[model samples]
Structures are given as structure tokens and as C-alpha cells.
Target: MKVLITGGAGFIGSHLAIRLLKEGMHPVLIDHLSEELPHARKEYQLKQVFKTGPAAYYNCSFLEREKVSAIMEKEKPHAVVHLGGLAGVIPSLKDPSAYIKTNIDGTNNVLACAAEQNVKHVIFASSSSVYGEQAGVPLSEDMATGRVLSPYAASKAGAEALCHSYRHMYGFQMNILRFFTVYGPWGRPDMAFATFIRKLFHNEPITIYGQGTGRDYTYIDDIVSGILLTLKSKESDVYNLGSGRPVLMSEVVDEIKHHFPNVKLLQKEARIGDVTSTWADVSKARVKLGYDPAVSFKKGFEETVAWAKEHSDLI
Candidate 1:
């Protein structure tokens, strides 16, 4: 099978592409490689994927409807995984228009092109941010997402609605996976885990915001496993691919301190658009997609630190 992934040069997209290649499937990637983002590791991530195997790559934004359509027509992929978008809650607040344009409008283009090509399956990468400030502990898919706290979250929710509409009209299988705080080797530099590691390496102080809030902190491999399971499923639905356990920011900092004992810490008020906590209820995914996240925070962090040290120049 051939699969096309937008944001293929990104951390998650690159990891997914390598996994698909290992499963004897062809993976095609499209990414704008935007320079405006906080990270500049797109080239490094793509090199890692190439090390695993040869895959077709296109450096183009999905916002360009004609280019997206042309790529879809040329590839004729069996599935489309939409993962391209401007990520980060704080950044989204500063430039909500960019988030809306890329996350919502760009998604429309991808969905339209997929429908035009008669693609069989599409997996939309949503976020746990959509369930902002929920009353419940473990967030379930059935819960309402009408109270999102950030433009980034709102954009994902809007894109998700578009996914359903396209599925209803075009009669194609659509799966929306709401990812939690995913972290691991080659993780996004903007994320807390990577940021902390970089600071520690340079003997700089790591900032702790909002009284050390908690996050699901799901591992990259586990997320990829969930994606692969969804790819094989026939049903179209939403699932939360998370660790189902929230780890406090303090605990994460402590874990990093275990490696860098002399790391400095800075405390600051939590910025706006930041959620207090995120916990995932993966019961639906477990029953429907057999999604099981096995890596613990300790083990995952250790592996991530090792990877970062090995490739210190990249981070």
C-alpha cells in the first residue's frame, strides 16, 4: 500500500514514514518546511527517514490546492494522513490567523484532494487541546469540545468537523486521532521535553510555568503504533492516542535533574492559552484499535535523553 502524509518531514510524520516503510508500504511525504516555526530540524528528521529507506518527498504546502491535488493525482495513495499545521498554543495566540489558515483551510484542501482522488482512508491528526478545561479526569472522545481554550485547539476542532463532513459526503473512512503531549527521540524542539533537554545541555535554566502542570506525555513509538492500528481499521471514528496517565511538570524536571544534577530552574506564571492538565481515556482506542501505550515516563525520558546526547549537534 502507498500512503501520503502531509508534514512528512516533521517529527511525527518522519517517524510514521519510517514505520510504514518497515511494514513494506510506500510512504510519500509533503511538507512546506516553514522557516517561521521555532524548529529547524526538518532536514535532520528527513535524513533519519531516508536512512531507513527511500521515500518520495515533496516540499510544498498543502495550502496550495492545485499543488496538493496534483500530488494526490500523481501518487494515488491508498491512504492520506493529514498532519500538517501550525502547532503550539502560545504561538497560535500570537498569530491565530496563521493557525486558522493552515490548520483549517489547509486541511480543507487536503480533504478535497483526497476525495477527488477517491482515497480510501484518511487519518486526521487532532490534539488533546480540544478538550480544554474539562471537568473530568480522563478525557473521552464522547465529551463535548465546544469549550476549547486556544486558537490552536479551535483550529483542530474546526478541521475535525471538516473531516466528518468530507467523510459523510464522499463515503470514505476517516479517523481522527487526538494526540496528547507526544515526546521521544527527534521530538519537536518547541515541546517542553526537548526544550528542557537543550537548556540542561547548555547549563541554562529551564523555565517552569503554571505551578508545574501535568501532561499525558505519550511516547512517539506508542503514537505510531496507534496510527498503524487505525490505518488497518475499517471503522471511521475519533480516538485518543495517549498514555492515559498524566505526569506533572515537576516530575519531568526531576527526571531530567537525575541526568543533569546541576540544572537551574526558573519559575514563572503560566501563560494564557495553556491548559492546566491533560489526561487521556484510551478505553475506546484500546477496545477498538488495540492501542496500548507501554513506555513509562522514566523509560521514555531516558531514551529521549540518550538520543539527544547522541545527536547533541542537532538539538
Candidate 2:
């Protein structure tokens, strides 16, 4: 199978590309290498993917409809995985327009191009943020969306709707995966775990917000596995790709302290748009796609820290 992944140079995208190559599939990647993140980090990720195996790459934004269409026409991939977007709840609040434009509008372009090329399968990368401020634990796909707390969450919800519409009209297989707090090697630097590691390495204080909110921190490998399963499935539906384990922020801090005993801590009020907790109910995915997350938080964190130490320059 030939697969095309937007944001292919990103953390999850790069990992997915390497995995696909190992499975004897061709992977084509498109990434604008956004200014929000360091180009060095993205370039490093690409290097890792290339080192693993051969893959085609394009440095272009999906926002450019013509370019996206041209790439799709040229590649004629069996599947398209849409993962490009502006991420982060706090950053979304500061500039909601950017998030809306990239997440929603950019998604539309990808889907439109995929439909035009008659792609067989399309996987839209949504987020757990769409479940926003739920009092309930273990969020499921059947739950209502658009109760979003942040513009980023709203954008994902809107993009999911677009996915549904395109699937209905074009009659193509559509799989929407709502990812939780994914972390592991090559994780985004803006993520809480990444920031904590960076601060600790420099002997700087790490900030804790909102009385240690809980999150379902899924490992990057698990997420990639879930995506691969969906790619091979004939059925099209929404699935939550998460660990189904919620760990409090305080617990995460304690885990970090285990590595860096002298690490300083700073407490601060939670910023707006931050959810109190996120827990994924992967029952549907388990039954439908045999999606099982293997990595425990402790093990995943240890591996992440080890990788961070080795590649301190990238972070």
C-alpha cells in the first residue's frame, strides 16, 4: 500500500512513516515545516525516517489547495492520513483564527483532494480535546462533540464534521481517530512532558498548573499501531487512540523527580482552554480494530527521558 501523510515530518507522522516502511508499504509525506516549531527538530525527524527506509517527501502546506491536489494526483496513494494542523490549547486561544484556518480549512483541502483522486481510505486525526470539560470519565466516540473548551478543540470537531460530509458524498472509507495526550520519543516540544524534560535538563523550574490535572497520556507507538489497524480495516468509523489510563499531573511530576531529584517546581493557576482531565474509552477500538496500548506511563516516560538525554540539541 502507498500512503500519504500530511505533517509527515512531525512526531507522530514521522513515526508512522517509519512503521509503514517496516511493514513493506510506501509512505509519502507532506509538511510545511511550520514556523511555530524549530525547523531543526522537523529536519531531524525526517532524517530518522529516511534513515529507516526510502520514502518520498514534499515540503508544502495542505492549505494550498492546488499544491495538495497536485501531490495527490502525482502520488495516487492508496490512503491519505490527515495530521497537519496547529496544535496546543493555549496557543489556540491566543490566535484562534490560525487554528481555524489550518485545522478546519486545511482539513477540507486535504479531504477534497483525496476525493478528487478517488482515494480508497482517508484517516482524519482528531483529538480528545473535542470532548471538552466532560464530567464523565472514559470518553467514547458516541458522545456528543462540539462542547469544545478551546478553539483548537472546536477546529477538530469542525474538521470531523467535514470528514463525515465528504465520506457521505464521495462514498469513500473514512476513519477518524481522536488522539489523547500522545508522548514518546520525537514528541512535540510544546507538550507538557517534553517541556518538563527540557527544563529539568537545564536545571530550571518546571511549572504545574490546575492542581495537577489528569490526562490519558498515550504512547506514540500505540497511536501509530491504531492508525495502521484502521488503515487495513474495511469498516469506517471513529476510534479513540489512547492508553485509557489517566494520570494526574502531580503524579507525572513525581515520576520526573525520580529521575531528577533536584528539579525545581513552580505552581501556577491553570490557563483558560485547559481541560481538567482526559480519559479515553478504547472499548470500541479494542473490539473493532484490536487496538491495545502496550506501554505503561512509567515505561514510556523512561524511554522518552532516555531519548531526550541523547538528543538534547533537538529539544
Candidate 3:
């Protein structure tokens, strides 16, 4: 099947592209976020992309509804995995208008085109931040999600609403994949993993925020599995794609220390809109989409460290 992946050249999107090619499916990539990455990362991953050779590529933003529609009409793709948007919770708080434009307005365009072009299925990339600051261990799909702490979370909630509207108003299936702290090779530099690694390499102080906030740090491969399995499903549903193992910020720091023992530390107050903690109840995914996350934090961190060392120039 010909699958259209918006943000297909991104960290998760690039990993997805590689998997799709191996599975013998034609995967078309749209990368408006190429410049969003660190310069070194962009250059390195671009070379890797050209080396593997994707099925097709569109170097334009999905915010352009007319152009997005045109691409949808021309490609006539069987499905769309919408991962295009402004990312990061803290960054969203920095410039909410940009987040609204990219995450909300841009997603509406993608969904509209999918509805108009009769795309068979759409698997959207939503954030667990939509759950907001809940006093709980494992957040479930059936819980209320409107109590978001940041503009980014609010925008994802809005996008999920749009997906529901399109799915009901039209007939195409929609599968909302709520990803939690996905990390691995070729990951975004803004994420904690990259920041800590870069700091370690520089022998700089790595800051830990507010009682060592914990998160369910999932691996890239497991998230890709969730996406692929969800694509194969016909029913419209939501699933949490996470490792299901929540770890404290200290634990993550220790995980890094396993590789870099001399890493310095600094303590700081947690930023506003930062959730107290996050742990996903992936039971729905386990039951429905057969989404099983296999990589533990230690294992995943080791793999990421190896890849980071290889591309230390980017750090």
C-alpha cells in the first residue's frame, strides 16, 4: 500500500519510513520540519535518507491546505500517518500561536484532505500531555483529556477532536496513537535524552527538575510497531503507545551515568505546564492493536547512547 506520512523525515517519522520500506510498502515522506532540527542532525539524517532512498518526498508544510489537498489527490494514498506538528511541551509554552498554527490548523488541513480524497485510514500522532497533570500512575484512553497544562497539549486535544469529527462525518477509520516520551537514535535534540547526552559530552551540568519528574520513556521501535499495527486495524479507536514503565528524572540521569559516570548535576524548579508525572496504561493497545513495547529504559538508553556517540558531532 502507498502510505503518506506527514513529518515523514522527522525522528519518529524517519524511523517509520525505514520500517515501511523494509516491509515492502511505498512510503512517501513530507518534511516541513527539516530546519527544526539542529544543523548537524539535519545534514546527517538527510545523507542517511538519500542513502536509503525513500519512495517520494514533498518539501512543503502541511499548513498549506490547498497544496496538502493536491498532494493527497495526486498520491491517492491508502492511508496517512499524521505526525506533522510543532513538538515539545515547554516549547509550546514559548510560542503558542505557532503551536496552534502547526498542530491545530495544520492537522485540520490534513484531515480535510484525507476526507476529501477518500483516504482509507488515518493514524494520528497525539501526545500523552493531553492527559495533563493527573494524580495517577497509569493514564487510560477513556479518561477525560481537556484539562491540559500547555498550549501544545491543548492543540493535540483539539486535533484528536478533529480526527473524531472527520471519522464520524466521513466514513474513514481513525486511529489516534498517543505517544509518550519516545526516544532513540536520530531523535530530536530538544528531548531530554539528547540534552543530557550533549551536556555529558561537554562535561556541563545537567539540570533535574522538581522532585525528579518521572515519565514513561518509550523506544522508537516499539512506537513504530504500534503505528503499523494500528494501521492494519479497521475500527476507529485510541491507543497509548508507551513503554509502560515510568521512571524518575533521577533514574534517567542514572541511566546516562551508566555510560558517563562523571556527568555533573544541577537542580531546578520544574517549569510551569510540566506534568507531575506520566505513565501510560497501554492495556487497550495490548488488547486491540497488539502494541507491545519491548525495550526497557536501560536497553533503549544503551542503544541511544551508542547512536549518539556515533553522531556526537551533532551533540
Highest lDDT among the candidates is held by which one? 2
- Output the lDDT of residue 172, model 1: 96
TM-scores, all candidates, are 0.97, 0.98, 0.97
Give the clashing pairs for model 3.
Answer: none
Mark the regions of model 3 whose C-alpha exceeds 4 Å error after superposition. Answer: none
lDDT of every model, 2 decimals: 0.92, 0.93, 0.87
- lDDT by residue (1-315, candidate 3, tens digit) is 899999876888888877887887888878765467865665565556666755788878998888888998999999999998888989888899988989998999999999999999998999899898985579999774599999999999999999999999998999999999999998899988898898888899898888848998999999998998987887899989998879887788778788999988888888998898899999999998888899988889999999999879875
Q: Give me the displacement of residue 85 in model 2, in angstroms.
A: 0.8
Flag regions of model 1 displaced more than 4 Å. 37-40
User: How many residue-pair clashes does candidate 2 contain?
Assistant: 0
Q: How good is model 3 by TM-score?
A: 0.97
Predicted candidate 1 versus true structure: per-residue lDDT over 210-302, tens digit per residue: 874899899999999999999999999999999999998889878978989999999999889988889999999999999999999999999
- Off-target runs (Cα >4 Å) in candidate 2 are none
